[model samples]
Structure formats: C-alpha cells, structure tokens
Target chain A: MSADADTKSVTEVRPGATPAGPPVGARQDSFAARLRRDWPLLVMAMPMLVLVTAFWWVPALGNVIAFQDYNPFSGGILGSPIIGFTNFAQLFGDPQFIRAVVNTLGITAFQLVFYFPVPIALALLLNSVVSGRLRAFIQGVVYLPYFFSWVLVVAIFQQMFGGAGLIAQILRDHGHSGIDWMTNSDTFILLVTAETVWKDAGWGAIVFLAALSTIDQNLYEAAAVDGARRWRRMWHITLPGLRPVIVLLLILRLGDALNVGFEQFMLQRGAVGSKVSEVFDTFVYWSGLRTGDFGYGAAAGLFKGLVGLALILVANRVAHALGERGVYSRS
Target chain B: MSTTKVSGLAPWEEPGSLAGRIGKGGVLALIVLAVLLPLYTIVLTSLSSAGTVNRVGGLVLVPDGITFDAYRQIFSDSVVSRAVLVSTGVTVVGTAVSLGVSVLGAYALSRPGTLFHRPILFCVLLMFVFFPGLIPTYLMVASLGLKDTYWSLILPSAVSAFNVVVLRAFFMNIPRELLDSARIDGAGEFRILWRIVLPLSKAVTAVIGLLYAVGYWNAWFNAMLYIDDTRMWPLALVLRSYVVDSNPLPTATVGVNGFGHVAPPTLAIKMAIVAIAVLPALVIYPFVQRHFTKGVIIGAIKG
Candidate 1:
C-alpha cells in the first residue's frame, strides 16, 4: 500500500512540470532551473528549517558539552577544557545519579506492570457498551483530565487526598485523623502511578478503541453460534484480534521506558522529598540548573539519550523481525 | 478485514445476563463518578463563600451557600490577572504562529522529492530518535537571549516535527488531480495551497490548532525555566506557585480591624485559580473532542 502511494506521489510531481513533453533525461534539469522552479516551495520551507536548525540541530551539537568540563563562566562550551570521559565516570560514581537511575527504572517497571493494562481494560469495557452515546460521554469525561497540566493534576490530587483535604475532613468527621497521603514518601510511587492512571488511562484507551472497532464482527458471531459464552468470545476472538496492536504498543512503550515523566515527578518532588521522588529528568534539572554542574548533568542526559536511541533501534528491529510495522518503515 | 459494514453490533450479541449487566453498569458508574466527583468538588469549592470554605477546612463538597467572591478576588489581583493575560496572549499568538509555520512547511514537504525535501524530511525524522536533553536546550535558549521572554515559550516549540509530519501526510492524501488542475489553470503553489489545499483541510487544521493551543495553555515548565520574573509568569505557572507549592495567595489581604476583609479562604482562592486555568480547555474541549480520534488515527497510520 505504502509503495503504491509513494510511486503515485512521484508521478504526481513529475506531471507538474514535464507532462506534455517527451521524457527529459532525469539529470537534464539543471540545479538552477530546479531552484528557480521550486524557489517558492523552498521559501515556504525556510522558516521551519531555520527554526529546526537553531532549536534542534544546534542544541544537538551542544551535546558535546557532555565531554567537556563545561563551566559556563569559563568561555562557554568552546573554551571549556575537554575532559575525556571524566564527567561520565563521575556520573557513574555518584550515588545520587545512581539513585535517580534506580528510581527511574523502578517507576518504569511499575508503570509497565500496573498502569499499562488500565487502558486496555477500559477499552474492553467501553467496547461492550451497546449504547454508543453513553460510551462517548464516558470517554469524553475521562479524557478531560488528560488535557490538564501536571501542576493542576497534582493540585487536584492534593485537594482530594492531602492531609487537610476532603478525604481528611471526612475522616476527621468520623473521629479519625487525616492520612498524610500526599507527602508520604513510602507511598510516593503508588500515588504518582495512580495520578498517571487517572490522567492518562482514558486518553490512552483511544488507540485500543480504534483497534477494537476494526475487529471483524463476524468472528464474534461465529464464536457465539458455536455455543461460546460472552467471556469465552472475549477471551478467544477479542483478545486475539487485539494481539498485534497490543504487541506494537508494548514494544513502543518499552522503547520509551526511560521517560517515566518529568513534569509529574517535578511537581511532587518537593512534597514527597527527592530521596524518593528523584528521577533522571529531575536529576538533570537539579544538577544542571540548580547546582550549576553542567558537564556532569550533560553527561547524564547524553547517556539517557543514547540509551533511548539504542532501545528504539533495537525495538524497531525486533518488530521488523516479527513482521510488524514498528514506528517507522524501512522504505 | 470484513467488507461488510458491521453495524457496530454483532448479530449473536446478547444484552448479557442480569448479573453481567449489573456488573458492567456498576463499573461504568464508578468510572464516571471517579472523574466527575473531583471536578465537581473543585468547582463547588471555588464558588463557595469563605465562611463555608473555612467551616469545611478544605474543598467544599456540599453547597451551603454560593458566592463569586473568590473569582472576583482572583480577577482583581494584579499578579493573577496579569498572568491570565500573559497566558491568553501566549496561547493565541503561539497557536497562530505554529499553525502558519506548520501549514507552510507541510505544504512544501508533501510533494515528495522536491528540492532539499529528502534532507529536510530526514532532519525531522531524526528528532524522533535523539533528544538534545535539558541542559543543551536551556543553554541554546539562554544564548539566544530568549530567557525571561515569551518568545522562549513560543519559538522553541513553534513547529512540532510530529505535527508537520501528520499534516504533510494529510496534504499528500489530497487528490493530486485537484492540485494539478489548479496548477494548470495558472495557480501558483502558494495560491493552490491557500485556495485549494487549506479549504479542503479544515478538520485536520482545527485539530492541529487545538493541539498546539492546549500545549501552549498547559505549558508551565517552559515558563518556569525561562521566565524568572514573577510578573511575567503565565497562568499555569501562577497556578503552580499558589496551589501546588502551597504559597499563600499574594492577593489574600486581611484588612486592618477586619473592616474590608473580602479575601476568600486561601483554599477557595486556589481552587478558583484552578478553575480559571481549566476553564478555557473545558470550553473548547467538546468542540474538538470528536476530531481527536480521526486526527490520531491518521497520524498513527502515517507514523
């Protein structure tokens, strides 16, 4: 399908300039001629290119500071002494950085294990609803929180669960003391995970719901006619139909496992204490901006970026081997 | 795939046993309650009088009495009112600029194998793999002297590579015949884009525009990083400071001798700010929600 589309687009472009004439040699058009013909298009593309170069490409080049003793006051990135692997070595040796790595992995694992299934489950439940209007309303309501900022989500959670919040007031009315849910370090992971589930589970279900809509209804009818119960039909027909999408999403999730989230953790870090709340992104922010250890922070961030890149490449390769269209196709 | 238009319901599908219906209904009810109850409380608390809020300690759950005092107080405060204006200006200007850039670039890139197209497309795709990390982006913004400026929020995120790719895919899907016929009629590329392409692409454009607007409105991290002046903070940043950080509302003044003390409880003020921050999104959400599924599916297929 994609190959056919690509060729069609190519043909479409070809007809724009040389439609009524015999085929000119592919190389016959001079660069200046092509430039004159397509200059308007180039002009349209220029601002985006400039912005991309300035914001993306230039900062990308700034990754070299990971290798330097990058003191901002000491002549910026250029005049900083280039130390080979010294910052990375220090990063690996730092206990705080190690803690951040461990915490990031721990959060990723919890999300994968606990939070990942909520969307699929919600999608399945919604899929069973015979009333489309009701399902749409529920979906809309649930998706609302996904649009809220992390700060707002945290504030809402605090208002509902904090020591002096609604739940606390209710508890006090029952002659019990309020629970310190928001600031409790021991339950930090659970709290954050719950917050994530509340904010994202409905929105995340969208892709799965789309996937479900594509399932052939005939299969379900056939299963039911074969004396299959509803649960049996769901287990056999529904789950199997969803397998490819589930696998695709799972692989993508694994590729993104390192990014447990930055803003969510950042908002709650002060309340929960950094010992429990620190993740890789916050670690970079604190070290780079707050403490002015640019080289070490840059090294840590570079390490993370490389790992993320490597994981995505490996995941895409695995998806190809399994005959799935991963994030991008080779063509 | 089934060629038949299965009527979203199967022939053998039963309404389910009584217990099953009850179970599903219960679960749906619980999910609905979970979402609505919190928002409901926040709005109610924001609208409650200070006496009721103080009586409840935090988050008024029941309506004993209603007042717009909290909203009035927040809107009157220079700090919060200015932040609201800043957020509004940023969201409007930022969305316009981003949509303009994205639409123009997507048009240019939609025709495959144009001059510099391959290299430009490669650069955009490269962004998906490697991040420049926090420090480098910060340094770049700082070096550009955009620090403490609204441009810092808008420019760094002006053209989302993902949005461009989605839009380019959509543009490519436009029947090539239409563009070609327009071209044959003496329409230039820009003219074709403006008259033919854009008019045909309203749904996706609206979707992308809303996406950018929501992003700008919800964005506080950029403001936190770039804008050091409290006076320049956007509504989201102000909401964070007064609500999440537990800072006392600067506008909540207790008059001497309690003669003119009109400030609502700090909790009420905070909830009012939250309500204000979320109000725009809530207002626009229903109009755009239907487009989300279509937009996402298109992007997912191309991506």
Candidate 2:
C-alpha cells in the first residue's frame, strides 16, 4: 500500500524533492553516514564491481582495435598498427562483406514476416483451450526445446532430417525420394525460420498469455450477452488487447534483427556452405580467426555494431511516434 | 482476521460439444507431440546399441537393444570425462561469482538518486546495444595473458548487463519502508543487503544463477576463441567438435580408451553429449521455471 501510495504521490513529491536538494547541505556530512550505513551493501557489492571492471570493462576497451590493424602474435593490441579508415574502406569494398550484410538483412526480413507472429498465434490458440491440466502440460512440453543448446537442436535436426537421418530412412522404407532440405540453398532462410519457430514459438508465447490474463472477464461476459460468437469476441476483444504487447515485441525484435545466433549459422555452415550461411557474425569469425584478417574482421564487427545501434535508435523513435512505450523512452 | 481471495472454485464452461473438445484436444495433442517427439528420438538413440542404430539408419526410435553404451563412452576415461569436469567447474564457479557481482551492482543501481547510478545504468544499456568486436575482445584477453586459462572463460562474461538489469528490477520492487526501517536501526547498506534484501530475493537470485550456470556450461565460442589447449576444453566445445566439426574420434591429445571399441562415438554418443551438456540445467529447471519467466521481461522490456 505504501509503495502504491509513493507511486501515486510522484507528481507532488517531485518539486519538493528537487528543491530540498539545495537545502540538504548537511547531505554532504550525511553522505559519509549514508555510506557507513550502506557499508554492508557496499561490501556485498564489491566482488561484482571489481570483476566487472577487471573483465568486462578491460575487454570492452579492446573495441579500439577496430581502428587498428590488430595482429595477436605481434605484441597484441598495443603493438598493432592504427590503420584507421583503411579497414572500414576495405570492408565496405569487399563483396563478401556486402553479401553478409545483405544476407543478415534478408534473414531478419524473413523472420519479421514469418517468425514474428507465430508466438502470438500459438498463444491465442492455446488460451482458447478449455482444459487447464492439458494447457499446462502442453505449455511445459513446448517450452522444453528452448532450453536445448544450439548444438542439441542441430543434432536433433540432423537425426531427423540429415542425409542418413530419420526422414531419409523413412523414405527409403516407403520407396520414395527424400527431400534434401538441409544442404539446399533455396530453402536456407525457411529452414532457419523453422528452427527459430520450433525452438522459441511456444516459449515466446508466454508474454501474450500474461497479457491475456490482464483482460477483464466482464468484457467477455458483455460480448456473450450481446450475442457475439466466440470468433467475433476473440477478434474484437482478445486481438485488440494483445496489440500493444505485439507492437512492443516488434520494436524489440527489430532492434535485435542483426543478431541471428552465430552458433546456429556456424553449425549449419558446412552443410549449406558460406554461399548461404555467411551472415555478419560468421563473416567476422571466418575473417578474424580462420582467414587471419583481424583488421577487416574488426571493421566488419564495427559495421554490425553501428548498424545495430542505428536500428535500435530508429525503432525506438518509431515506437515513440506511434504512441507506444519504446525500449528506452517510457510512453 | 479476514478471509481474502479464493481461486479455481468456479465451474468453468464446458466447450460446445464432445466433438469440438476432442478436436481442440487433438490439435493440442499433436502440437505437444511435434515438440516432444524429437527429444524422445534423441533419448532413444542415446540409449540404444550402435548396431541397432546403424540398422535403423539413424535413430532406432523403438529401442531394439537398450544399452547405456553411448553414455558409457562419454563417461569413460576419455577427453569427454575431463571436459565434463572442466565444464562443471567453470559453471559452478562462474555462476557463484556472476551472481555475487550482479546482485551487488543491481542493488546499488536499484536505489533511485544514488550518485553515479545513472551513468552506470547508461553504460550497461550501451553495452547491451553495442558490443565490442570479437578480434579486439580476443586481443584483450590474449594480451591480458589469460589465453588457455579457465579465467578466460569466466572473467570475460562475468558482467552480464542483462543479469544486472534483471536483478536491479527485482531489488527495486522491494519495499522502501523496510529498507528505511533498517537504515533507522543504523544498519549499513551491506548489512541490510546481506541480511534483508538477499533473503527476500531468493527467487530472482535462483533464476539468475541458473541462467548464468547454463550460459557458462554451454559456452564454447569463448573457449574456441581463447583456448589453444584441447586439454582445457569444456564439454560444450568437445560436443560441438563431435556434432558439428565432424571429429567423432577423440583426438590423440585427448584421453581415449585402450580398446578403442568406442564405435566411433556414434550419433547416439553425440546425443549423449547433448544430454550431458544440457543435464545440469534440466536438473535445476523445474525448481526455477516460474521465477525465470518473470526475470526475462524485467531486463528485456526495460532495455
């Protein structure tokens, strides 16, 4: 109740709290008292702060290598020559790099069109099911695959559909020609989308289900009383109630469009070959480690980061324009 | 004393007809089956005899000869054994350390109007949006003289911005009056955090801990990037080599069995490795599943 009261009192408290800021000169004296009072928390917090600085912060500084020609054997980052825009120029000019950009964008586009609405659809259908026990059981089973590592997912797929896999054996048994969905370039995007859906569709449906719970029961009663059919009520009430959440998720997904997991692409790369699987992350992997072009790799990585940053900014701005809460800006 | 809300007592509406209910149930049943059948096949293949598997062409779904030979192969005095140990150690140590740090940072950042809080929060957001490049990250690790070390795996990933954000949200939800009362009692921040906040935050902590453990256990990319010594390989990396990189034969540098009757570590073995890689998370997941879902959006939507 106090928490609720505090939240409600925000408007009244703001101006008071702001002006109190100046007269709180003893705040300086109290700072030490405050710190002393908070010492236990400070102590509890020390390990995390130190570890983050030592590991995350220190390694994060290495992003500067994108400006330099980093050769690991040549005294590491310090000794690497600062080649500056040369790396970027080379990256921009390279056909493979361009192809990777195109490929990543294309994959994101496909996922946006197909994989985006799957969870919503699944959630709507599942919510309509009458059996509570059955619903929970199905939900549990559906979410299980999400916990499987990419390696396991790939292996499962391989066992089911690889050259010597289950479908092939089934075809062999039935005297039918097997479809080679695995190594085929034409269906690469579709395969990736299928994998995404199989792994995440059920798990991702969770938010929608949570949203569905927030809908008032009286609306449904009203619809029933007004002689609305189940389908009509669902279309009028359920879908509209879910729209805000869908828009929120769409913006978030758009922000992360570039990051189709590297492990999934890497696992299937050999089968499909780089011609199809050479997305940005894999391009960085190949160029940096396998090909030993650290500068170019750094440049490619920088490009990806910048584009991702730009996309998030654009997406958030668009969300704000549409009168929805974007990632950063609330309402 | 007053009685409050009651739930699940209302008579729920039965759907239109038995046929319709069956149709809905059938559709749901099919979806559940489609999701679980692959997992069933994998488990079956992992437990079957190699000959039976080979005869069946891929996965001998109906177990002709149910044997734990594949599991035996993975558990044998081979590279996998050491790899599993290393993976376990990394996961255990990494999760503990990651949770310790995340909780502290989250607590600090959760307090509104703290000095330096906003900047720290901004930095975390920046990290989430724009990552440092791989080469630079590799060079930084290598330059720090951490290559081939276990610390290379643990340290680089210790500061998860996502975890910090989640924990912070959980901490923020704690009653301010309770904290103020503790403060009035002259308890320090650390004392209050350790004594009060953490006790109340077991759910979020457990979920974050599980996530960190899984991330560490399933980490191969870091090892591949930083570690040159196959002797120091984690289970995930070794499993990747078996399943993806096509090296079923455990390398000479890796400890192998004497008779080499390991049967080229069959697809079943690959599944077994998958099982092994996933086993710890699977074990702990049921206990933490409820909290884990709540934790995702706390950080995700905030971002």
Candidate 3:
C-alpha cells in the first residue's frame, strides 16, 4: 500500500528512484564502479541469492521432470524420456487424482465459508473489550497454538475428540458410547476447518486488529452525532475501514485454494484414509514418495504450481477491477 | 486504549446497555475459556499421577495426586532426552542462521535504488508466489547428499521470502533522514545498518527471530522427510510418534504399566510429551507478545 512496497513490475527498472546515489548511465555508474561502491551490499545479499537459487529457482526449473518419464534411480532428471502431456493425461484420467482435486477444492471452499470469518469476528469482539489486559491475555492464549506444529495441533484435537479423549471419556461416564472424531471421515472437512480456526483464528486477527486500530474513530463519532445506531456505525465505518485488508487476504487465500496444506492431511491420512484426506500436496507426496512415481507426482505438483500462479495473477486482476490494491499495486 | 481516559468509549460514543455488556462479557469469556481449557487439561494431565489418570480414565481433568513422574520418566529416557537436545540445537542454530541471512538480505535490499536491487527483489517476489515443486525439491535435496543430515532440515527452509519482505518493510519504514545522516558522515551501508537501523529495529528483529525459532522448534516434517533415522529425530517428530500416533517410545524407561504402580500412567506420559513440545513456544510467546502490536502487525499488516 506504500510506494516503497511496490517495485515497478519486472519489465521496468527506474534508476531515477535511487536515493543519494549517482544516476544510472552516468560516467561513474558503470557496473564495475557500482560494484566497487556496493560490493559489501552484494556480499551481504550473496547468501540469500545462492540459497534462493539452489532451493527455489533450480527446483522450479526441475519441474520439467513433470514432462518426462522421470525415474530417479535409473534415468534421473537428465536421462528420463520425454513424454509430453502423458503424465498430465494420466493425471486427468485417474479417479484418485480427481478425488484429490475435488477434496482439496472442497476443503478450500469449506474453509472460506466456515473459517474465514472467525478472525474478523474475533477482532471485532476483541476490539469491544474495555480492558486491554483481558484482550491481551486472550490474544496470548489463542495465538499460542499457531506456533504449534500440525502434529501437535492434531494431537491436541485428538486429546479433545479422540475415542479415549476427554469428551469421549465424559460421554462414556454418562453411559453413552465414546466416538473417535479423529477418525471420522464423514466430518473430516469440518474437523480440519475447526482445527484451522483453533490454530489460526487469533493470529489472523492480528491483521484485522491492525486495520481496526487505523480506523478513524471520528467517523464513528460523527455517525453517532447523526443518530446512526451502533450497527450502522459498524457497518458503515468499521467494516469499510477493514475492507482492504480483508480483500487482500481473500485474494491471497483464493490464490492458495489448491494448497490445503500437506502435514495436516498427511498426519491424518492414516486415521481418515486417503479417500477422505487426500489433497494436492499429499497427493504429490504419496504418489511421489510412497509409490516412487516421481514423474507422476511431479506432474500433479507442476499442475498445482502453475494453477496457483494463474490464480494469483487472475485474483490480482480481479482486485484491480474491483478498485482495490491487491497483493501488489499496479498503477 | 486511546480512549481509555473517556471510560472505554470514544467521547462521542454511547455506553452499552446491561444486556449488551452481559453479552459481550459472556462471549469474550467463552472464547478465552475455550482456548485455555484444553491447554489446562493437557498440563494437568502431564502432572497427574497414575492413580489420578485412571480416575479420569483419560486426560486427567481433576487434579488428585501431583507428581513429576511423567516428566521425570520422559527426561530419563535416552530417546526423548536426545531428541530434546537435537530439537534445542536445531532450533538454536537454524534460527540464528535464518535470522542472520534474512536480516542481511533484507538490509541489502532495504535501500531502494541500489545496484540491481530491483531485479533481485523481483526474483524474491517471483519465488514468493511460486514455490518449487515438492518432488523436485526433495530430489534436489537427496541429490545434494543432504539426506539424513541436519542441514537438510535447515537449508531448504532457511530463507523465507515472506519474512525477508516483512523485515525489509520494517527497514524501509525507518526515516531516510536517519540513514542519510550517517551517509553524510561517510558511514557505509554496513555501519549504518548495524548502528542506526538495527538499533531502531530491535523489536521487529526479536519478533522475526522468535518466529524463526518457533518454526525450527515446531518443524517435524523436514525431519520426517530427510532424517528417517529416529535416533536423529527432533522433539516434535518424537512427540508425533508418542502423542499423535500413540506409539510407545522404543526406549521408554517406564514401559511397564499397572493401575496404581509407581510409574506414571501411559496417558500422562503421552500428555507430558505434548506438554514438553509445547513448552518452548509457550515460554517464548510472552516475550514476543509485547511486540505483536508494535512490531509484527506493522511489519506484516501495514507492509
């Protein structure tokens, strides 16, 4: 939302923006001279560039393995036979892959409906509290779980809802049968959404809370002066003030729709079975690691990455069309 | 907080009705209790004695007999103890390296019009959207001969583009006059970043460092992927086996179980493992809690 945050798109390199430095194309602005002046800065940036290359860029290029009949042991990436669209052809034909895509998209839509409003509600509720001490205490308690790993979050849910968990124990004590919600595939989508809410609702609210704080209180007062009711003030002033943050996050979430997370589903895949638990990431993981169909898995993953890229660009365009600054501002 | 002097209301705002007050207070308290109750139960179960655990049948709620037997048992076990050490070392070293590299990168890219900064920043942003395919990354890691090594856990995940950008935002927010003042005094970018920028960025830096440390501590998948050797597993992976999978520790010191024997209950030990895994995050949270409003939100939300 600031001029500093948006580097003009990659096509444009405006050297005129440099501060207190010699203008580009100047006699002293040659590469060697700039390197002499900024060698330390380049040195500082070297480690990151190297790590990003080795980890990010190289492997991104390696996504080409998706196009090959990749066998890690015999052929490796280089020796693999090229098999254009065959893996993807196989991917689209497979019922299991179809199920995974459906499940992933289903979970994304489900969380958007059930889980997305939680942090907004939490921020509004927290903002209403008169006591800062109490609000901080709630934030500290709630955000604690966000730092916990998926293994730990799932374990906590298990302790609360597993067959021998506290709720089950309580039910058994009351002469009812104990049910293992952890293994209940029928409600797996809801279960994961609940888990997501429990872990992230507070952390997500931090963004909204920031937006809320930035809201002009005078608007509320003026609305009140005009005989606007509390709900009216909230609707007219508060929600609109938080609109940009909400839209930005919504776009980001839309871009991330295909990725419902790996470890969460992978951990539960045993209890819930792949039929219920399979998402895009776990599909790639299982088809790659478990079955060693590296090319097949790579194809599925490549499909996901490309779609995600498309989704983000499209979402950004949509946001621009809606007159909001999306992830990055365009004009 | 800005309107605190006006009795929790902006001067022009109306006071709440009794019903409204009751409703808000009730809902807020419920949210607080929902979060705390499970945590309380886990901690209580971790401390419960064998008799106490059986009395509750699972996840001891009412505290009857208090003993450190479960904690003592897990700590005494070589597997859990060594895993704890591994976790601590990885968290420390990984967090330091990540924070160092990220801060250095952020500073280098912090200056807006530096040489090739735009192209480099664009590269970072490009990676921010599209991660490398997982299978490809795994193959790369395996090909690099980093399998089963701690470096596999650290290197692949060290430089998060998100964190770097957030930190860079905070750095960029610093008044340019401050940096220009040092530049006018003939101080280099390194000297200026160290003396002027870093000193002013302690809170954001601390929050970022804690985020990395917590990430490193809580990470298990990397270890699960790369370090198949249970002997080299971190505490989180161990926690998964014992707590999530309900698998017994191979080196469990108190494997024998009876109703009221001296050994802690199996449930208590499992819960104890959960508690141990959660403790570092719990301990480190409050220190960073102070920075959430000031540092994290501004770096993240405003950016």
lDDT of each structure?
0.83, 0.74, 0.83
TM-score of each model, in listed order = 0.92, 0.90, 0.94
lDDT of 1: 0.83
Off by over 4 Å in 3: A1-13, A17-28, B1-7, B250-265
In model 2, the Cα lDDT at residue A322 comes to: 91
The CA lDDT at B302 in model 1 is 57
DockQ of all predictions against the true structure, Cα-based: 0.51, 0.41, 0.56
Q: Model 2, range B1-303, lDDT digits (tens) per residue?
A: 001102232233224577876887788788888877877787788888878877877777786868989888677756788899999999899988888888888887666444444345555555766777676677677767999899999988888877887788777778877977887898777787899999998887887887788789888889988888887899888888777655755565443565333445567777777777767867877787767556664444442
User: How does model 2 score on DockQ?
Assistant: 0.41
Residues B62-130 of candidate 1 have per-residue lDDT tens digits of 898889998887776677888999999999999999999999999988876466665666677677777
Question: Could you give the candidate ranking by DockQ, starting with the highest?
Answer: 3, 1, 2
What is candidate 1's DockQ?
Answer: 0.51
Compose the digit string of candidate 3's lDDT tens values, residues A210-248. 888888777887899999988899999999999999999
lDDT (tens digit, per residue) of candidate 3 on B1-303:
234422556667778899999999898888778788988999999998878888778887777878999888777667778899999999999999999999999988876556777767877777757868888999999999999999998999999888898889888778888877788899987898899999999999998998899889989888888997777999999888777877666444444332223332388888888888889988888888888778888887656
Q: Write the per-residue lDDT of candidate 1 for residues A166-227, one digit (tens) a residue.
A: 89889998999888789999999999999999999998888888888888877877888999
- Classify candidate 1 by CAPRI docking class: medium
